[model samples]
Target: MIMCREATKLMSLKLDRPLTRREQLQLRLHTLMCSACRRCESQFELLHGLGDKLPDTDDTSSRS
Candidate 1:
């Protein structure tokens, strides 16, 4: 079983690129068994969607 940390990493990567079949399966299986990871994934997706709707701001302080 994939750990919550690894599953969260996969979820983040999914935002930028499609996961490989194996990666997708791992994340899916992990989320199925781990409620906390599933909630984290849901919150991340919601935050991403909200961010997409906001206009991009030139906040240099936010960038490393």
Candidate 2:
């Protein structure tokens, strides 16, 4: 079983790209047994999605 820290790390990486075979298996195993970590992972995904929707400030001009 993967530890909480390891699982969280892998979950973060998954935000950018699909996890490797080993990482996928580890995360599955870890989440199956750890509810807290799973919740944390879910929250991370939600926050990541919200961030994606935010507009970039650099694209906006301040002239008025």
Candidate 2 backbone clash number: 0
**Candidate 2 lDDT by residue in tens digits, 1-64:** 7789999999999999999999999999999999999899989999999999998786357655
Q: List the residue pairs that clash in candidate 1.
A: none
TM-score of 2: 0.86
**Which regions in candidate 2 have their CA more than 4 angstroms from the true location?**
59-64
CA shift of 29, model 1, Å: 0.4
Say what the RMSD of model 1 is: 3.7
lDDT of all predictions: 0.93, 0.92
lDDT of each residue in 1-64, candidate 1, tens digit only: 8788899999999988999999999999999999999899999999999999999788996899
The global Cα lDDT (0 to 1) of model 2 is: 0.92
- Give the local distance difference test score of model 1: 0.93
